[model samples]
Target: MRLRALLAERLVSRGLGETRDTRPQASRLPVLVPVGPQEDPVEAEADMRRRLHAVPAGTDLVLRTSGSSTGTGRLVAVSARSLLASARATHARLGAAGRWLLALPAHHVAGLQVLVRSVLAGTAPLVVDTSTGFRVPALADTLHRALRGRDPVYLSLVPTQLVRALQDEEATRALRQVDALLLGGAAASTALLSRARAAGIPVVTTYGASETAGGCVYDGLPLDGVEVALDAEDRVLLRGPVLASGYVGAEPGGGACDVGQDTRYHDVSLAGGTGQGIARQEGGTPLWRPGSRLPVTLRPGFHLLPTALPGELPAKGGTGTVRVLATPDRGRLEEGRLVVLGRADGLINTGGVKVDPGDVEDALTGIEGVAEACVVGVPDQEWGTVVAAAVVLQPGAALDGAAVRRCARELLEGSHAPKCVEVLDSLPLRGPGKVDRRAVQLLLSRS
Candidate 1:
């Protein structure tokens, strides 16, 4: 109910009371922390209230990313402007802001955005009770009830949800009726996307993170104000109003970004402003053009980590006049559309050679009967780190470890081939259905 009340404030004033005329008299506003579906809601809300002073003023929502993906742990601070910008952009893209069905956890940006859209549209969002877990029948039943009105209803989900939904005829048919079904949080396998489309489900592949206030790009195209660019090393750079204000430290010892301090690891000749499809280098020099590769240089300064990740890439607010996020993910422009490869941090470095697991996974999935694949780097005595894989075969399909290796070698041979492959019934997941690479690495290490 408190979450809904906070969302209601978005209606009375512009951007959660950030407007000049309607500003509240409070010196510091309390940060809104969403409770997980299964968590004790009363305790979670009380905990957030107790530590209200830690969060800086002007922060609207505080969200945390899964520990499995990012190396560190911290809370993402999103301002009202960023959230509204993201929600409006989505409504504009979908052509109408109608009803929305929330299938993801409220703690996640995707699920929060669903409520935002519903609030903006003046309709209470129909939520599928996902506390126990995702069930196709519950999703189908809730979606059925949500579709009674003439207003177009929308659904947001991850790849794993769609995989299970396609198995049931009622779930698949119910999903097909949604105005637009968003698939994100993790890469959708080629086979999964094909099956969803063949089943007549409207699946729009999304690309973004909690740092960007959910997905700024939908189906290979940037949303209204969102811009996409690549730095010299092909690291994805994003800029727009959708970017979060900054991040707050999780606690005293989370090993994440420091709260209210210098977050920059190295000094860069940075110059940028708030806009679309354009980025500024030093001296206000425009350096990036859409659908083209542009290299932004980083001058040597205080280096913390050796990884190509901007050491601790400051958030849109913490940085400076520059508001771009240098995402760990790597991507390339394909015929004017962004094709994201695997994350740069997730790359397997074997024998001093860098290998992208996405390339290997894509190659493996190209083989017949291979449903999905996750490639990781397990510690090897000789190679320092060697490639390994976990695969989920298509239903009723039989495959062995050798066959999976052969398929991987056929396309990405040499150092990219998996040293050992584990054929699991399903890949392990964390958060809203992202592959748990850390778990995969641990499992492959034992084998």
Candidate 2:
């Protein structure tokens, strides 16, 4: 609430009239119209005004879920209090004093956070028009102009934007000038991260959502007062000061389930998991994992699991498979350092063994003629799903599928090798800069 009040005060102070009430809107296809000096602010304000006036004062703003890949709509309401808490937590995490270059859309939480952070940090964010799609050279030029005063600059971008920037010499140079480049909204590929680090970009990957006030966890670490724990099913659950008041339409559960309570349930079902369990109690219903259910006891304040599930427990102790449920794809904590593995969906399941495609992709990076390769699983009567790779060879480079398979065999295990290789000019990439497996399957089927 303090953070929301602070944001409202800041907006009002910055010439936004008190009559104008800022409200968050949720939509399956949320439109993010980038307004500039040339655009009509009166019209823009009118549109927002109409939306805010339509909803009652107590009504929460339901924003669409960040990723629409699953075709499931998750409406996350950003309360006035949660918005402010996020700003404060972000301010505390990322020290004050720095201008932010906003390339992300305001409709999404990450972009909204950048704008809010700018207001809370006492600096207005410089917006870049990515509506015409990302133009690395143009973006770099705008960023260079924005940094004319030698002021420290900060920017937030998804992995795709970062990868495109790295491919452009001008953009890459421009990125090196920034104080920090926060990457989130989706998982960044290992190839992309390695390239950024090599280019000397101060890149930081953030994890969180609109429910947690945006990026509560930066680079695998939680922000101040943010608590992280794995439920019995190994799904990540978060609590602490940064949590939203509650979703709009959802009942006001009670005191213990009120503001600052565990306010999120990340669906890890795709990776073979279930929901975090719940416990019934006076004044509140406790939510947790069912099997490893905690005692029907009340702890006055917030608590975090010291380590991730399957982390504290011995690896080989259980009879069932040692399924490692990672919240973020590709990263494993080894000796306290986060080593990313890419995305879980990107993993290739061959012969009943899981093969992280990233590892195979890394191995094939330096191979001759192979420009880009995406490993995926294809329906097989014998193997259920066998590893298949879609490869894009460099211009004028002759590609031999057999040679590529031989190369993979030399670098990876027999089960991990691509069982079938389909050569293409390019791979289908999604909005987040990840390989669009569905599109690839369609292309493969046609071929």
Global lDDT of each model?
A: 0.73, 0.57
Model 1 spans > 4 angstroms off? 10-29, 40-56, 250-294, 297-320
lDDT tens readout by residue for model 1, 1-447: 457668657534543432346654444445677767677978877865664445544577788777656544457777777887888899999999888898988788888888777776778888898767888899999999988889888989988788778878999999999989989888887878988999898888999888888988999999998877776778777777887766564453222222112322333433333221222233433344455454452211111121112223334544333445667678888776788986777788999999888778877877787778888899999999999999887777778889888877777768998988899988888876677888888899999
lDDT of 1 at 234: 83
Write model 2 residue lDDT over 1-447, tens digit each, in one string.
233344445444433313354443332222222333334879866755544322223223445443433333234445545555676777677676578877866655777677677765666677687667557776797789777855678888876577567767889988998888888866555666777889999898887665676777777776777655443332344665666433333322212133224423222111113223222223333333312333232222222221223212212333211111123233444443334455535566656798877667666655766666766667777887777777766556766777788888888888888777788665675433445766776655454
Those runs of model 2 whose alpha carbons end farther than 4 Å from true positions after fitting are: 1-60, 245-349, 357-375, 389-406, 421-447
Clashing pairs in 2: 1-81, 3-84, 4-84, 26-62, 277-288, 279-286, 330-340, 330-341
How large an RMSD does model 2 have? 10.9
Best by TM-score: 1
Every model's TM-score? 0.81, 0.65
Cα error, residue 371 of model 1, in Å, equals: 2.9
